[model samples]
Target chain A: MKRKQVLVRIFSLLVMLSMLAACTPAAAPTAAPAAEQPAAAEPFEIAVVVKITGIPWFNVVETGVDRAAKELGVNAYQTGPAQADPAQQVKIVEDLIAKGVDAIAVVPNDAKALEPAFQKAKEKGIIVITHESPDQVGTDYDFELIDNVKFGQHAWDQLVKHMGDTGEYAIFVGGLTVPLHNFWADTGIEYAKTKYPNLKLVTERIPCGEDQELARQKTLELIKAYPDLKGIVGFGSLGPIGAAQALKEKGLTDKIAVVGTVIPSQAAPYLKEGSMKEGLLWNPADAGYGMVWLAKYLLEGNKITDGMEIPGMGKATLDGTLVKLDLIMDINAENAESLGF
Target chain B: MKTLLRRHEAYVLLIIIVVSIIITAVNPSFFSLENLFDLLKSMSLMGVFAIGMLFVLISGGIDLSFTAIATVSGYAVALALLRYGDSLNIFVIFLLAGAIGILLGAFNAAIIYFFRIPSIITTIATSNVFYGILTVLSEGKWLYGFPTWFGDFANIRLFTLYSPAGNPYGLSIVTVIWLALVLLAWFILRYTVLGRSIYAMGGSPSSAERAGFNLLRLNLFVYAFIGLMAGFGSVIQALLVQTVAPNSLVGKEMDVIAAVVLGGASLAGGTGSIMGTVLGVALITLLGNGLTLMHVPSQWYDVVIGLVILVSVGVSAYRMRKNIQRRVITETA
Candidate 1:
């Protein structure tokens, strides 16, 4: 019985090996939707691993990947773990590496945790592209849909637009330890300090954006404690939603403004109702499309350039494996639906 | 004074008043009617979770899986409602969530009962399983865009009172459900035979078995009740926030457990009260609100909270050891 079990395991291993070889770079792509122009080039395989699958944010990313595949005529697809955990994300990356895809793109759940996996992928000669994570170890390049500094500056710009240089505002990041959120908070606060000197920050950053409930509760207290407050900057996707809910509950919806990273659909009702004036975010779809396109460009043996255009993501300026795009979207009540989830 | 000091509820209440006074001194708006109403609303969801934990603690059993059960059941209900709940009553939706929670709780109960394992270990294991299954099913998705009627149902309020600033605030549905659950939980613990049995079990499971209780049936009832409350809390939570982020609720068990334990509930079981639990939760919420209002640096807030919990629990424990009467009896089997 033990010998038979060993034989079964060996058989499965052989099958998996054959499957991997069939899908590896330069060996697949006939299934691609017919493109407008079919150039004579072997279709390279690219895989984009998101933070998690089946989420509205990443669902939009999937569409961008498919569109890039159809247009660029590459065997590009998207996959990720069901949950947003570094361990799960790392496993998916390892699997993609084992499958020997020509390129791999990731929006890491935890950039540090993926360091070893990215290093392994690099050793295998796979071109690695990352979105929302820069300065990551062992990566071909890291790209952002929007310049980080400007994204933060733009958030303050929205706040100042509504509050007219502001009376007082507070910032809420997802957490104090979240690097991206803190970076945005720092830049936004700095922009407000110089550009709109009258715009006062009521306090240092409050870390509660990841939890809608905590954000709402904190916003309630912020309003009560600082009656002079005029605006709030929410530096996480759920941050704006929770702040808006607190404002609506207080009937201060029209009195105070909230603007920052927000899911357009989640923030739409509030925007229409005047709890928030504007929400600033980059489309995840653009990030998804841009990364895959960059991966294909590199797999074709083109060295990274200073000012190359990433498809659908505008022009990219390179900075030592860190790419930045001057792309940002301002979602208001009038145009939220058009952005797509 | 000594009698009053002996009661845990009075002790918690005193701490709350002290905290409130300090906060009001720092930010006069802390005393504002609008802020008071808002605080009440915010406490409701955590209030429900703590009540369930209180029961579990009093029964000498620990449940680390309520948060997982709550999120999974709540997310499922939200998705189902969005897909096929046009004419269904909102109350029925909440009930469905509770039923799902009970089923999840039953899994914990079955394992602990059959294997005769410690509940803490069993629930810790179940917490991961429940969360894993939920993550797989939901893919960490957030369910939004409820039907118009659903939003309307969520917005139902007891009454709206305008603050001096013309800002409206009052009792919201979340608070109302929490208040109802509190009263129901209080009754079950205060007036039922099953309630007495639970206390007995916590005090000594062997003694409880000797006292004519059906151990299996009692275990099932106790765990199922925790499930029931978890389910209800999840619905109220999702309704208040207007979205279901499947992953948000799991890591919050620590705070809930902290509140329950802070209320003078013994980790070893057999001693606690509803009033103490309520006051304990209020103190925690007050500090949270007060710190943010005082503009204390965010990084230092957790340190302050940890210190406060340790100090408060420490003081009570020391006082009990010194001032309270104790009868120690130990014997060979």
Candidate 2:
């Protein structure tokens, strides 16, 4: 009975300690505005949450958030789950709500999974701005850097040009479930079918699981399987990089063309060598910067009307709380280094 | 010849051949020399880990921490390379990685030996700890920007074969290292006193102790040895890719475990061979490679691998039952 009492005490102590720890970070942000701004009004505290932290894509996005924070004088910071798990992301959002941030901007891994937490944040009067997740509900606005159909058509045009308008081409996406990636793949294939009659897809879109090695191995096998394959359209950032590496190693760069939504830094060497012919992506930093800008715009009683200029993101079109922008950056050897991401 | 046919390694070898033949029949490009070399090169990394896993399995312990050891050791090497720059000797980086691996391996061994906790559970916990430390230290960032020599290391081809189109292909130095490790492991397991003790321990711990084998020393050595192999595997992987992602290798412990188990190594303990492990690695690698060559959807690959494991285990169980029945009949006679 004495041992049992001790165990109960210890368990309760642990519970208390964890609650304190959770409250500590939440408390620190609140204290910051009070301590720093004694004379002026409290700065808008905007928290930008991404799908995952510590990846190169989101790392670039964080830089944008930092840039916007500096420029706008808002207490803006970015946080996300370590892994791309929707449940973890929702937890972060809930914690942010508890901390009483004025606004929450998120890029969700799963749109439906995050709706409940987002709904809670909305109930607490927290302004919610999301990027890259158009289907996300319970948000004041969800912003997209590129129009899905337009981007798909653009990628198809580039692939057609490279393939001389005819050959067996393969398509790869980050995963079967990533909605945006699949949208791009679907529209790209549809556009190709209508616009370029000669080009053919070798197989249904293969999923890379966002892994570079998996992409590389799949590309290697694809090359072996289809000797006359002329082009590859990669829908994820790492897909083209992996395909290019495989093609470069086999000395098939001259024979085949590869294009994808790849980071400029990773695709630079491949682009220069003609292994990777083109890369299509919007500036992630811009998207990151834009989320905060949109959040602050809504917080200050601004309406997201069509053609209204967002500071970081240029002209935006409003479609039922979804702000879409056409900001695709065409990456090639000539301008790869200048982009820096 | 009949006995050879009945051996597990022989069955695995036959599977490899059959898979290759079918894949080649569908796509002749799969039978090319360059493709074979590519498949072997990819298999070398997992092949190295399987050797270490073989030791642990034979000693009646399962290690889930080998990949974690590889990640931390590789991260340490990457840090060393960054700190020392061009002036640092490459060999020293490898030695540092090996040392870190030994320390981590010792930690796992000490816990399992001292507390008598199940090795699987201990390794699972230790893997998380090792990976957590690595993530905290590196911030889950990828390490790149190695010296020219590091990049050059990956391109060091020995006995090159050139295609008619002038594309060079051959075995790499890393693959050579992998081959050497396999030979060394085979020698130790087949011909050494320590190896016999490990098998004895796995077969029955109390009897091994009665036979005067030091269980604690053997356990420590086996785990540490696996760690050492992990360290070497990490260095090879770093050299192979020329960029190290800390998180990329953590989830691959499953592949190593799968390969070891598929090699006819009984998870319950004691029976495995270096040759069987090599064949197992080759079969798994070829399955992935061949499926891709056949334009098989990537989603189906996981299902296929799961089915293959189930079937292979079933075959082994059936063979064991038959062997036992034969022994019983002879004893009755």
Best by lDDT: 2
Weakest 10 consecutive residues, lDDT, candidate 1 chain B? B324-333
lDDT per residue for candidate 2 within B1-333, as digits (tens), equals 125323888888888888889998888889999898888888889999999999998787888789889999998888777777687776787788788888889899999999998787688778867776666667667776677677677767898897665667798787888999999998888799988789889877889999899999999899998999999998888887666777668668767877887888766566788888998899889998888887787778888887887787679757866776777799999
lDDT of 1 at A18: 52
What candidate 1 gets wrong by more than 4 Å, as runs, is: A1-55, A62-128, A134-138, B1-6, B319-333
lDDT of 2 at B182: 95
Q: Could you give candidate 1's per-residue lDDT for residues B115-194 as a string of tens digits?
A: 99878767766777777777656656688877777877767778988888888777777788888888988898889998
**C-alpha root-mean-square deviation, each candidate:** 9.1, 6.6
For A1-341, candidate 2 gives per-residue lDDT tens digits of 22243345336434644553343223212112223444477889898887766668887898898898889889888887665667767878898899999999988777888889888987899999887777777888988998878998999888877878989999988877676887788888888778888898888788883677778778878877877899999987778877887787777898889988987877787899899999888999998888888888889998879888876467888899889998988999999889977
Minimum summed lDDT over a 10-residue window in model 2 chain A is located at A24-33
